[model samples]
Target: FYIHYIASTLKILHEEGYIYRDLKALRASCAQPVYFSPFVKASNVLLVEGRPVLIDFGMCKNISKTGRTYSVCGTYHAMAPEVRALSGLDHDTRAATTSGYGYPVDFWGLGILLVELLTGKPPFGYRNGDIGDLFELSRGSPSTIHWAAGFEPSRDLRDLVESLLQPDPSKRLADWNATLNHPYFAGITDDMLPPEWDSDLGTEL
Candidate 1:
């Protein structure tokens, strides 16, 4: 259900030329005590209506074919490895290669969102309970991300999530339409998707 919802949301968001750089559960709430992100510990997810919504604008940016943005923004736990490297906060803390990173970051975040939706936690979430620790876990082997007990998501969903979590920005989802057509959303249809109220919200940049 979340994969379908996110795919639809991203479809509309990308169609409107916006990149949701910091997509996370925290962003789902309009108001909350703790900041939205995997590392920011908080309980009680209050659902507005029947569907969850993505909030926060501190890190989103405009999508461009040739535009490059550099900023240390977004929830660290939900950030793409490329964004983390660019921010100089990862374990390596080395300067990035200075390439343009935009839509790819959001796609990576979408992958994390899918994982959290299925398992009630993000793939890199660990006992460390800090942004840096989450990022470190993300840097570890792929097998580290596994579904917890009582969950049996299909392999297609898992594969799609893995594709989204790929570290290389160049290999992320091409567009929302492409994502919608992916195998993960096999039987999902437009009727099953939710509507976007913020359809006209411009890019943060």
Candidate 2:
């Protein structure tokens, strides 16, 4: 149900030209995300009639034609590498990136959310809580990402997670239309699919 709920939420967010702020749900061991309650902690999520609803849009950003925006916010582990790297930099430096972080950060967060929900741990491991180390791991090749033991997820799930976790937002899955068709979401019920909406990102970057 979380898979369907989150997928649908992503669709809604995409249609609205908004992206989810980095979630801080998952923590060490039971950072409380393993149960699929949302480890960035469930403070941002709520259950209504057994349906998981995402809440807290305080950090949401409006999408531009280019999908790039400035200012840094998001939590460690869940933060996209680009966002993490750019955070704390002066405005001039962030502007120099040619493209500041955008909708892709949400996809990255989705990947983190999924991994935590299914694997009981955020990708790259979370034993140390060192933002620097997490940032370094985020910048590394996605192939180096360590999937947890005892959790042999399906190939499609792994593929989708890796794709969403792409360090480069350009390569990550942010398109509302494209994400709905991922094999991982193949089993999502029709009611769980969010209504379609126009996007400046198009099908992909």
Q: lDDT of each structure?
A: 0.62, 0.62
Candidate 1 lDDT by residue in tens digits, 18-136: 78777876665422222233343434332333354565666666665555677767766777777777766566633233464776777878788777755667777643564555554
Q: Find the 10 residues in a row with the least total lDDT in model 1.
A: 30-39
lDDT of 2 at 152: 83
Record all residue pairs in model 1 with backbone atoms less than 3 Å apart, i.e. clashing. Answer: 26-36
Clashing pairs in 2: 24-40, 25-39, 25-40, 25-41, 26-39, 26-40, 27-31, 33-39
Question: For residues 1-205, what per-residue lDDT tens digits would candidate 2 score against the true structure?
Answer: 5655666776777777777776534222221122343334443443333455565667877775756787777765677777766664322222123357777777778788777666656776653553444655444557656677766879998888888887767777877667768888776764653333333433432
Identify the leading candidate in terms of TM-score.
2
